[model samples]
Target: MLRTVSYHPVVRALAAHGLHTTVDVSRTYPQRRFTDERDRQYAIAAVRALFGDPAGREENGRFHCLHYESRPESR
Candidate 1:
């Protein structure tokens, strides 16, 4: 399951106090469509809404796991 720390500053700060911060929005378990950009956005937004922005955190930022991509034949 793809996981990461919560985005909320408060939540993240409180994590040391025995709070749960790991979010599991893996497409495989939830049966989500990773192919659709909208779906991917939704998943990311959901994380932000539930937690908060982790961009301010050190060594942390948004990322995507695109194993491969296809280019147009003409290109």
Candidate 2:
């Protein structure tokens, strides 16, 4: 079963930092939401390079955002 993965704040934050979030980022990693700045930056770069643009929207309330998964990215 798919899990919930809301990475709006992180993706938004990365975009704000001039990092382009991409879609291929979906399940690109073992986990979503990175606490480490370096990891986040790397992930953003990687996803941006592979996916190009990050698409997301708020669902199940303004708090939950669908970053890179239909249901969730697990964890």
Best model number under lDDT = 2
Task: Give the per-residue lDDT of model 2 (tens digit) for 11-43.
Answer: 687666566655543432233455566655554
Best of the candidates, TM-score: 2
Residue range 1-75, candidate 1, lDDT tens digits: 222333456555555565554433332222323556665565567556656342422113333321222232332
Off by over 4 Å in 1: 1-33, 52-75
TM-score of 1: 0.27
C-alpha positional error of residue 69 in candidate 1 after TM-score superposition, expressed in Å: 37
Could you estimate the TM-score for every candidate? 0.27, 0.29
Worst window of 10 by summed lDDT in candidate 1 = 66-75
Candidate 2 Cα deviation (angstroms), residue 21:
24
Candidate 2 clash pair list: none
